[model samples]
Target: MPPSRQPGFENTRSNEYWFCFSSPNVESHLIISISENHYLALAKGPLVEDHVLIVPVEHMPSTLSLSSEFEVELCQFQNSLQRYCKSQGKEVIFLEWVFIRATHANLQAIPIPSSKAVIVEKAFNLASQKMGFKFVSKNFDSISDGRKFLKTQADEESSLSYAEISGGIILLHHVEEKVRFLAQFGCEVGI
Candidate 1:
């Protein structure tokens, strides 16, 4: 069999999807590139202030959809974004909303007050507790980084995790659909 096309890209070429940063037609200002595998770029939008999108060259649907190696590559770019923003005295919140599984994936990286980073973590953890599951938190200190962590622990049974990396720590938690109530289904839910 021919190599299977990723879930979202089975019927379309990269140019057909506006969010495919890897496409030559995407006029988004190039920022930093990691390899043919991924790149970080400034997407065209009002959230242009310190807002970056970590995009994979392949058309994966979500972070959870990525294989161990892709996940590691994605996190490496995220780690780079985190450290650079920190050095500039700015903070970033990296997140992905993937309700629609047929489009390319772009992890949004936005800056916020350094102090509010803790508040964001508390809000997610508290939300998880409300849903009756403690946030499955992990720190990469024991390992080299997220790739190592996921390679050792992640599996198919893993639920979708919303990550908030702050203060050099990465916290993963489930997005409770019950709490996701009262909003239009998709991106309107707001991060």
Candidate 2:
């Protein structure tokens, strides 16, 4: 079953509410929505444009504890967004993370050029440094160990597949670098 709706809320539009937040580092703007009891937003991060964050509306410590329904909704929303991006002629890069200390679970999606693999790699390295988390580069065969690493973190244990972590970081860095690149195109990132 879906989580109960928060009290004192009227059905304004389609079972969800969207709110836009002011972002300092992004000029394109950040628009957020509370839909189906989850937090959904569009953000223009540093490395890529049209970045989106999809999170649980209620405070949840980690992805490991998310209800099955929330997981389904998240996946459905992600797929729909990816389709939308594809229709726009941009490839969507999906990223998900369970930060031990953060109260909410997060998933980020960024649009990037198909040929920027090297730049994506560099961005991953930079994200590792900024977040103070070790970045491990590995292939599919080494994913089990990676899951173990996340499982041992102090605050909570959440498993992350190698593909998930690698792809997630790449998307993050791509968004982080978007603003600087946008300048060359004569567009300013307002926030």
Candidate 3:
């Protein structure tokens, strides 16, 4: 028999699959597009109403081995989505680029109030490091015509994040822990 179909991709004739990220209790607001190969899905998470997940079409064992193009495209799309959210007056918390051991690679864009950028960044950095991931900072605003470039990347990826999806719950919890840890350090987090 051919490979067993994933729940959402039951119809072989379809190129896109629309379904909830994980739990229906989360409101099922997020949407995802599964790749033709069924190896990846571009998911929009709903952690803060404006989250996005850039997932790989294939289930990679580790994120450290992803293609350079895939990584770049993921980040670029994330930046564009954040810009769009900002234009809509939505708050952006932080972006979560996650690599699950058993599934595809995913990049989640979480929206938080602008006032919480610094706090969220610091918390994410600390939490990511604690999780054995290296932290690198990229100046997204410094890129030339950044939004356009990112939009192009998004099209290439063919994915979007939405409200009520919790695809990146693990990373979200990590961020929450970091925020709590920062609060314990006497930092007032206003998100």
Name the best candidate (by TM-score): 1
lDDT of 2 by residue, 1-191 (tens): 11222332222221232321222232223445557756667654435567777666555544435666776666577667667776777655555444332334555656665555336555555645664544455433332333344334423322332123224332121212112221111012111
Query: Which has the better TM-score: candidate 2, or candidate 3?
Result: 2
Cα RMSDs, all models = 5.4, 10.7, 11.4
Q: Rank by lDDT, descending?
A: 1, 2, 3
Q: How high is the CA lDDT of each candidate model?
A: 0.58, 0.44, 0.37
Model 3 — TM-score against the truth?
Answer: 0.42
Runs of candidate 3 exceeding 4 Å displacement: 1-45, 62-64, 90-100, 122-191
Deviation (Å) of 83 in candidate 3 = 1.4
Q: Model 1, range 101-129, lDDT digits (tens) per residue?
A: 23566777877666666676666666656
Top model by lDDT, which number?
Answer: 1
Q: Candidate 3 residues 39-112, lDDT tens each? A: 22234334455445554445432232345565555445555666776687654433322212123334444566
Residue 18 lDDT in candidate 2: 30
Judging by lDDT, tell me the better candidate of 2 and 3: 2
TM-score of each model, in listed order: 0.62, 0.49, 0.42
